[model samples]
Each structure stands twice: as structure tokens, then as C-alpha cells.
Target: MKRLCTATLLLTMLLSSGCENRPKQYERTQELFGTFVSARIFASDEKTAEAALDAAFRRAAELEQTFSPTIADSELNAVNAAAFSQETAVSEEFSELLGLSLRYSQLSGGAFDCSIGQLIDLWDIGTEQATIPTDEELHRTIHPAAHEVISLQDRSVRFTDERVRLHFGAIAKGYIADEMKEVLQAHGIESGTLSLGGNILTLGCKNEDEPWVIGITDPFAPQEITATLEVRDLSVVTSGRYERYFEENGVTYHHILDPWTGLPSDAGLASATIISQSSVQCDALSTAVFVLGAQEGLALIEGLDGAECVLITDDGTLLQSSGMDAYHVKQVEK
Candidate 1:
């Protein structure tokens, strides 16, 4: 649960090596998804680029309202209020996204649950309220199993458990990135990069056929880069313990909470990076693999079709899926 992104412009974040040279780059950075969303559009002229950027970010803003679990008026918040009591009607888009989230929750054995709002709030990892609670406190908070509680039919959400609540912080950024990329493409913007916080989704390749290069953030050193990769029309997303954590009595408490234990995950992974055609998949699977730990996480990525990952283990070792070699050209920093 990476929390509290700085409300600032995208300042050449450590995630990507960045683009250079010509194609009429039109860049705009705005704060969204609790982090800065930077869009770099390469179009024919200023007007085309501006229109694409405006339309793309407008869609992003709409999604921010629709998907935010904490917002009072958000659709997800509405579902949380009404789904347990009634068959709450949701948009076709919301129904579809929730369906995908449920599938992922099953696949991860609940490691990447979206229905853990209570558990997350209990931990309160990024705020002053964050503390190591007693076993009694853990016992009291009930994180409903997503499989047992949630049901969807005909663009409506229905659920059985009162404990179940929606929290889309994990998937919304990537989902919005995937969407903004579509908006850009629909506007006939050929080459661009749309980054929603740490999730970097690229449009067509840079300068025609060249691949976009992205750097992996160093988990141990948040200010630095560990490695970089070449990719085309692909997204690079990382979920790491370093994103949010606090030290207490010589023990480090991070924000990546485990749904099973109602505490932070000690899953032997400092970070997990998923490289895929789909940004949202990268988003969900990155957190999933991190919470699953190094060995099991690597195995999970290897088994999945069209997905590859680079895992940073707790001991600071780098591991990768079988096909990661195709995109992994740079050795990680020691």
C-alpha cells in the first residue's frame, strides 16, 4: 500500500531513463491519482498535442472520481455503501474492472485484495496513526475474503459480507494509465509516454522504431536507479516496500500490508517489477508478486502468459522470470 504521493509535477522520475530527440514532443504533467501524471505527446503540431493531452487527462480525472474508494461521491464508495444492502448498480466499466480484480484476488490467494479497506485503515501505515497493534487488535479487524463476499451480475454489484469494502489504490493508477493511453491513441497521437505515478505506459516507440527505455528504482536507495530496460508499447510498474515505511524499535514497518495476517507483508521481497503489454496487469501483478515473496513470486510470473517480472529479494538479490532476459539488458546496481 504505497501511500501519499507528492503533489508535484513529474520531475524526470527515476523510473524511466527518459526520451530525447525529435518528434515534436508535447509534455504536460499534472497531479492525479494522488501522484503526478506526466504525459509526453509527440504529434504533428501544438494544437493536436494539446487536444490529446487535454482529452486524455480529462478522462483520467473522470476515472479518479469513479474509482476512488475513499472519496465520498465515488462509484466505488457508493458500492461500499450500498452493495451489501442492495444490488448496487455500477457502470459497465466498473463491473468489468471489478470482475478482473476478483479474478486476480483468486489467483493471488487474496494477497492482492481490493476488498480490504478495513484492514488498510487499521494499519494506517503512512499516517501518524500508524503503529504496531497488539494481537488483540489484529483479531478484532475482519478482512472479508473477496471470493466469499463479492458478486457481480449485469453491471451491478452485490455482496454478502458487511466486512467487504472497496479499495482501488493498487489498481486505479495503472487502469487510468491504460485508459489515458487509449485516449491519446484515439486522438491520433502517434508517439508518447503516459505515466500515472510510478506506472509508466508508453505509446508507440520513440523516434519511430526505437524502444522506450525505463529505469528500475533502487529499493534500497529511493533517489537512485537500479537498472534500465528497452520496451515498446509496454508498461513498466514496480511495487516496493521502500515506497512507504517507518522504522520503529529497530524494526522497519512498511506499507505493503498482508491481507491474511492484518499486518505488513514480510514476503522476502523489497520490490517487484512487472513488464507487460497491459499496464493494469503490471499494476496488480507487481503488488501480488511482492506480497507472494521471491521464490513463489518468480514462479507465479513464469507461469503466467505474456507476463515477465524482475524481482528484488529481501537480501537485495535480483531474480527474474524465464523470459525476462529478452527485455533485461542492464545489470542491477549492487
Candidate 2:
């Protein structure tokens, strides 16, 4: 669902035409985590570049195996399956991710939660059986007490409620993207791009002087862009109701469910895009901000030191955080 805007396309063309010393750009794209994941490297040779890209993809696949909720033997599934009865010992990485998810859930005052797997299954927004769950079904499945039910102790997870389920879909892609960047860097890659679906991270600048240009999608018109950002060594993660939804009886339902209401959040905003140094934070905060809406979401981004946000309301109005001015290039006119 990510698109390269006109500005970025033009920049890439210009760079390629004018710069004779532009390192060979090698790219690998594959299906991972149920989405298109790609890695582009600027390397001097093909063999080294392919090896590094392979490592990055392998790391992504490994992380997906560990975290995917639907995967039968994932550590997350193990915790969900066993913690209903007793404490579940998880890998250090699994515990760390769970701890981080819990922290974000608390930080957002339950606006963003990882313990919404039951509700997700009930709604099934993106699958073929996607449908609206009844009030009774939602009431029975929704559990907003993730912080209280889940406990992390010595890399182990315990659940007080037998029904508690863990879902990291909101933040797992960003975490995996960060790990891929690390793998690329470990292979001496100084400049590259990792696009795990819509979560985009640029490793260093596009070149010595130009920053990577990221297109902010127009939620109302998915084919167009609302704005473009010039950034370097940053992560841009966007969460939008338009990304996944289903229509029934003239009413449209989105995938972003509010933990408190156990329904798709109608927070007066269509999308929330976050720019941060850490892709994981950007991913978590984008969902949090979408749930928080414009006023509170902007406030949250402003309070964070290395975070900025772009919020597009349901009415098509665009709003940006105070710190976003530095990266904002030019807004596209409707």
C-alpha cells in the first residue's frame, strides 16, 4: 500500500542520470509477514549485496516465525496457549517484545493494546470471513486490562485471566524492520532502504547530500499523496483505517478497534503517520495516535523528543505536529 510520490521519483531519476558514481542499487522483494517486504542496498558489487540482502530477509523470516500469532509453534502462540493455566517461560526476545508492548499499552491509557487477539479473531477484518461481530460477541471477547492480566518476570510471561490473548500485529513489523536494518549494517551497508509493507526505514541518507523522500498517502484517495517528507536515517510508519476494512449494509468498518469500546475506532481521523528514529516506536505510536485522534495524538507526538506526526482527519484536513515542519517539504494540493 506504500507509494513513491512524484517528488521522490523525480529525485531518483535525477540522481541516477547525473551521478556517475552512484553505487549499484540492488533490491530484493518478497512476501513476508503477510505483506510485501523489500530491501534495497547500494553496494559496489552484486555478490556482497545479494548476500547482505539474503541475511536481512532471513532475519525477517526468523522474527516472523517467533512472533506470528497464527503460526502454530511461535513463542507468542506458546505463551497464549499455556499462560491461560500457568506461567509460561518465553525466549528473552519474546519477553522483551511483550514488555515493550505492555509499556505502550499503559502509555496510551489502553488506547493501544497487544491483548486484543480475541477481538481481532472475532472481527476478522482482512480475511475472507470478515464480518461485524455482534454486541454480545464483542462484550464477551474484549479485555482492556492487559496491563493487569499480563505479567513479565525474568523473561517469563504469566496471565491472570484465562482468556487473555497476545497479538503483536501492530508493532511486530516495525520491530522486524529494525532488525533487518541491523543486519544490513552488520554487513557494512551504510545506505539502504527497508520497506516492510508500509513501514519504511532509511539507513542513512539517500546519498551524501539528499535525504530519502517519503510519501504520505492520502487516506481519502489512496492513489494520491497528501504530502512528502525529506528525511534521513528515520522510520516512517503510518496506520490508517483505509488499510483494511469491510463494508456491509452501507456501513464501513475498519480494523483499528478501540480497546475500551471493542469496536473500530472512529476517532475523527482517517490516518496517523509517525516519524521516529525507531521503527518500533513509530509503529506503536501510529496506532496509538490513530486511537487518540488529532488533539491528543498531536500532543503525544510533541511530548516525545524524537517523534513527529501527520494526522489526516476523516474530513480530509491535514494536521502536523510542531516538530514536523523540519521534515515537511511541500503539501500536495487537492
Best by TM-score: 2
lDDT of 1 at 195: 78
In model 2, which runs have C-alpha deviations exceeding 4 angstroms? 1-22
Poorest lDDT segment (10 consecutive residues) of candidate 2:
1-10
lDDT tens readout by residue for model 2, 1-334: 1356877888889877865756779999999878999888898788879989999999999999999977898878887888878877888778877888888888788888999899989899998999888899988987656787799897778888766889999999989999999999998888988899889999988866688999988898888888899889999999999899999999999999898888999999999999999999999999999999999889888888899999999998889898888896578876
**Shift of residue 48 alpha carbon in model 2, Å:** 1.8
- What is the number of backbone collisions in each predicted candidate, taken in the order shown? 0, 0
Q: Write the per-residue lDDT of candidate 1 for residues 1-334, one digit (tens) a residue.
A: 1233542223336433344334588899998756889998898778888999999999999998899865679888888888988988998778877887887888888888888887777777878788887888777766666866799886988878877888877887878888899999999987888878778998889989998989899898988988888888899999998898888899988988788887888888889999998998999899889889988888888889999998888787888888877885596546
lDDT of each: 0.84, 0.88
Q: Residue 96 CA error for candidate 2 (Å)?
A: 1.6
Model 2: per-residue Cα lDDT at residue 83 = 88
